[model samples]
Target: MFDSRHIQTFAEVVRTGSYAATARDLGYTQPAISQQMKALERAAGTPLFVRAGRGLRLTDAGRLLARHATGILSSIETAHGQLKAITRLESGRVRVCAFPAANATLLPATVARLAASHPGIRVELLEEEPPDSLRALREGRCDLALAHSLGDDEEGVIQVPLLDDPLLALFPAGHALAGSGRVGLEELAAERWIAGCRRCRGHFLAACARAGFAPDIAFTTDDTLAVQVLVAAGAGIALVPGTALPLLRHTEVVARPLTPALGRRVSAFVLAGHETAPVTALLLRTLSEAAKDLEPAAV
Candidate 1:
């Protein structure tokens, strides 16, 4: 069998195109680098390199090995990293995918806590809504996902409930219902509506339907800040999640709890068997803690 160190030397030689250069880079003698290549070629039962004047040329077998070298090296590196992290729990990376509201509200605190507690652990964040975030988690693009559902059970993954983010009604400060402690969906049926993301809009439609009216949607946008801006301009009223209320930038807009209290359950999702992964588990705990902090004050 070809030794991994020999394969490493071969890949380096392929990159630098010089045995002498590879040796210099890897801190070995030139003859040692050449000997390692000979071993690799013998294990493969084929000539991997050919002499071409003053330079070396890769034979067909060498080209084939080179094609696979990158992936092989990457897998080996990842395995080593995982082993090291398992041994120390001091260094690792966790990629997280979350929706905008949770990204704004929960991720900052979660990342901060993780950084303070485990300075060597790094977090990479991406923003995607529901099914997409879940897809990313399953595809291995993200280690964790902050996803929300309107009471439907998500299959094919481990789900940990974080919090229920209530949907709040937003109106212009001077609007008649703005001063009300709680506004019923049907009460705003005649007013022009500004819709948010697809999921949020779906929830809004469902809530309005339950209240016996269809909203007259005049504007649609996925940006919470824009929704607030529109509401402040008296362009249209909107329903925004409580977690996103803290991001409200327009003072002319007022938020109140919905009469029936519609909400989405926010949760952390991981691959079915990976919930106990060290870094991911740490993040899950941090997210739960952050959500608890937001619970009492949200909206």
Candidate 2:
């Protein structure tokens, strides 16, 4: 059997493509890495590397072993983490790729609770739209992503639904609808509409179309803040998530629920099966509980 160190060295060499680069990464001499690889090759009874001009390359057997070695190393690391967590060292890192709206409300309390409960864990917070966030999650750039849905795309991910975010109409405060608790989509459908989400903006527009008018597209932007700013400036009106309500600046903007209410479904996602990691599990539980705990109060 190849020694773990030798296996690691071999993997590193395969990863970097050159013994010298592996030496730089592992803080070892090139000769040392070469020796380790040679030892690993001997143990496997195969020539694991092929000499190439100015660098080294993995043979077929080397490529196969490298793949397995990478997995084995990861499993060992996770196992070590499990053992540490078993001793109350509850530790690891988790990331959240979420939209700014959710981050403003949900992430603060969730992370605070996490810090209090598991000081050993490191948490990273990022703001991204659902589509972008899910893409990041799939690319392994983040461990978790908070995404919004309109009751669609629930496939291919482990989703934990958070809340049904009430959709609201945003308008300049002194506008006719400010004091109105809710406005029908038709109320502003003919008004100039500066919107968000080129890809999904049609959903909101289509909802309006169902009410008998097409919105006048005055402008389009992705930044919710910018959208709200323009709306506050009387640039146009927008249908925005109520979760984004708290961040609206000034009394100039009033967010009132829309009648015939269009609400958005929000959810958290972790790559399936990866939810088992202790750190990820804690985050999932705490986040779901936080959402539940806030829902009634916020309602």
Top model number, lDDT:
1
lDDT of 2 by residue, 1-299 (tens): 76988878887787788989999999999888878887888899989888899888788998888779988999889898888874463767788999877888888879888889888888898888868888899889999999887356546678888888877788898888889976888787668888886876767877877999878888988777888779889999887776766677765787888778887777889888977777778888999888886665343
User: How much is 83 displaced in model 1, in angstroms?
Assistant: 2.5
Q: For each candidate, how many residue pairs have backbone atoms clashing (under 3 Å)?
A: 0, 1
Candidate 2: worst-modelled 10 consecutive residues by lDDT: 148-157
Off by over 4 Å in 2: 2-83, 86-89, 150-155, 296-299
The Cα RMSD of model 1 versus the native structure comes to 8.2
Q: Write down the RMSD of all candidates, one decimal each.
A: 8.2, 11.5
Candidate 2 TM-score versus the reference: 0.70
lDDT of 1 by residue, 172-200 (tens): 99999999998877788799999976665
Candidate lDDT scores, in order, read 0.87, 0.81
